[model samples]
Target: MSEQDFLRRLPEAGHSLRRRDRLQHRLHLDFTLLLLLALVAGYGLIVLYSANGQSMDGVQRQGIYFALAFAVMFVTAQVPPHLLRRLAPWAYAAGVALLVLVLVLGIGAKGAQRWLGIAGFRFQPSEVMKLAIPIMIAAYLGRRLMPPSLKHIVVSLALVLLPTVLIMLQPDLGTSLLVASSGLVVLFFAGLSWRYLLVAGVVIVASVWPLWQFVMHDYQKQRVLTLLDPEKDSLGSGWNIIQSKTAIGSGGYSGKGWLEGTQSQLDFLPEGHTDFIIAVLGEEFGFLGVMVLLALYCLIIARGLLIALRAQDSFSRLLAASITFTLFVYVFVNAGMVAGMLPVVGVPLPLVSQGGTAIVTLMAGFGLLMSIATERRRVSR
Candidate 1:
């Protein structure tokens, strides 16, 4: 296909990404975002390579995943936002149905049963909710004739919470929290009332203690309690937190310098290639390295928000904002969990962690954001 014809796509189809517009803007080629993802993903490759200890397969596969994820990001960027909007409700429904199936036949791994196997492919339904809830809520609020009302806000919250409660039932606390945050962004962007926010806060506080006491599984409660002081149970439930802290604090300023990290090399911190990779970064890269990484993430998210601000339609605006904010939460939660400031939530570091599905999903979200930011539309900016 011709370049313009490729990127600027069909109207009814929603995608308008023509290959010709690939370099229409200077900002699209910014190195900060790529640098951040590369360093983090690079660290995953390093740690996974070592963690394998026997073969380089894990890291190699992850390298392939990174390449594929970036490719998806590129392709999605070429598509238009309206296309994604049309897909939102369908995506949400499919996500929920899949979650229900997981509740029935999900393969239990670690401490939760959240994945479904198809032939040789294994999928996590919770990941779908991460993307779906935001899109669904954004589309709903954006479609309102006027700014959303309390009733509309309540509906939005329900859209967010339904999946949260269901996922929590799977004991997938990490994903459930992420899904909640994703929905919150849409409500916030939709201009929800402060009264609603206050009410939600009160409800949260009222529920937390009871939830902690009764609703949370014993291990889940232990994670929260352990976050306060991992040393109290250093040898038991606190080991992960304590090790993560040690790895971070020991890095000081300039880091131990790649691959030279003793903690990661010794395999003291758990899930080095997955949830705890931030700990690996902290151990090897030190304080300065973290700053660099954070800067990159900030740039990427900021760019996404900028795109949302310029969106020609409310749905596109809300969706873009929610996606950007949720990306922020992913980095924040994972880093917080690894730094011992928060409990280990089993959340992967975006782009950096070694998970395949998360990499693809998050990259796809970025692509959609790029599409929203760049596409020419009928709606006013």
Candidate 2:
């Protein structure tokens, strides 16, 4: 071709390139899941603004967190599921190593040593385990048999219990439970036997006494006690539950309007910008707002499960299901605790709560779901 002819073709080439880029972008992102996530995160910012005494600081910071989270999600979605399967064991090992490092040179807040401070930035290693454990289990079991044989189930439980024990030792009951549940969800989805599940339930019931007596810390026990009777020490450890319940109850049907929550504004509700943010939503936006938020969550969960069902491999299916169930646990625990129906375990509401680590981790999970949803199986002639 002549140089002039090549030059003329360059514009057409550029147009084609732009078209391909748009197509690739569309293929790479899951619009339905993304929309649901954005809706919840946007609603979160609104609720957060009110919860933070109408201050923009919380909302502004959370917005930054959301941006970072979306970026992580996008990058993660670009990674193929096969690569993720290959990387799971390594990721899980690294996470467990970090947890060990935290135990050795950990930082404390309030009373628990659950964070590792690296060059002035603090992070909870337990958060990584929440995803890592499930990934590791899925990678391990997916390559093996379905409904995992007894031996595999034993191994899976060990994988879960090790991290759970470590995190519990960190005295972080909330995160430990979440991590444990993540691994268990993978096992369940992998087709663990019903008989095994029943036995496990009985064991859990039998272990509660020992867990409370030997495993739980004084404060942890106090939380359980407080859950039973918040009024027993209304001015002490019970104060949080009391105020949270009051905030939720006072919201009635329609809320008091944004920024007008008496409980949050008057500082009667603690952690209104974080763990108990749901109560703020309940108080300011009312019960209807809570339902809308829950509906968004349900849609996300439904989409995630649908993606899992359509996954081309067991790894994607198990990981997707585990991540989705973990999300359910997060929402359930946060809302239940705020409503005084469950013990306060410091679980932040999924994407709604103000936490960078949780946001990034969760978005990454969604990204993996997208990868599963969009991945096309290769065929050879």
Candidate 3:
């Protein structure tokens, strides 16, 4: 047969395979999850092209990042869970130590020291904690019985809070919150009690005043105030939100069409290729496009949760669910900031925003989830 004919017959060949054979074929990787990620990443590139005024620079960089992320994911999947479990503490310790190094010898930008630079390369150690904390918590709690006692919960909280405090000292509230939440979600999935959750919620509420008064920087306070009333500083700190909302609202149902968004192309929207990329997407692709993007995200989350449910072990389940919820936090926070529903933070939209650290870190987390899924499939056979 000609190569073209052989290529065309592959689908029929696949259809004729036995059910067990098909299952084995599918076990190479979670193709459903891969398809969803590809759809989102492809759409992101299109939006990024428009966001950058038809410039290819941002898109090229993002494409490279995606390529590297995929490679990392592939490599990560080859490692078994047992090894990952054994290495969890070492990884967590390394992450915490890096965060401390960042505080003492880190590079600073815009009055914040959140990155460590060595030999012309720089990365945020907090990003490492996002994945590391979850692994550490999952490994620690997975060994214990379900519905952990108050003692286990306290130890878990300490595990989470140590890195959180280090990141907070870096004055990176966004990353600190993310790292802390990633660990906390693992605890919740590990069967931490609702009464404890209630008590924690109360403590959070009570600490709000102290956080605002002592922990928050002046600019951070400005961001919160601006969220409450953008008009108060329309020409200053509120400018980004105002322009973002206008761009989103102007796109209507059908959008202004690709590369024609005046708000982004004309430089009215701030951070059009980064944190506020959603506003640019909304401006060029409209509400319908937003819905499509959101649907892709929903599918990814659903698949991740499905993987967690199918996982046979507590560690796998907790790690999978925590990674999924971390993705949720990224989407929710970025969307809320752009929509004027929450104070602006430094979060970039997952898989869509132009960033390297976040993309790589998140993809690695997904890879770990895939490893768990593959392990489950192997054991089932």
| Deviation in Å, model 3, residue 317 alpha carbon | 0.5
Task: Give the candidates in order of TM-score, highest first.
Answer: 3, 2, 1
Q: Which residue ranges in model 1 land beyond 4 Å of their true spot?
A: 1-55, 377-381
User: Candidate 3 lDDT, tens digit per residue, 1-381?
Assistant: 999999999988877665645563355466678789889999999999988879999899999999999888877776667788899999999998998899899999989999988788788889989999999999999999988888999999999999999988878888888899999999899886789989999999999999999989898999999999999999999999999999999999989999889999999998999999999989888999899999999999999999899887888899999999999999999999999998998899999999888899998988888888788656766
Model with the higher TM-score, candidate 1 or 2: 2
Which candidate tops lDDT?
A: 3
Cα-based TM-score, every candidate: 0.87, 0.92, 0.94
Q: Report the Cα lDDT for residue 30, model 1.
A: 24
Range of the 10 consecutive residues with the lowest summed lDDT in candidate 3: 20-29
Look at candidate 2 and tell me the lDDT of residue 183.
93
Per-model C-alpha lDDT, please?
0.79, 0.89, 0.90
- Model 2, 143-222: lDDT tens per residue? 99797899989898899988898988888889899999999999888877789989999999999999888888888899
Clashing pairs in model 3? none
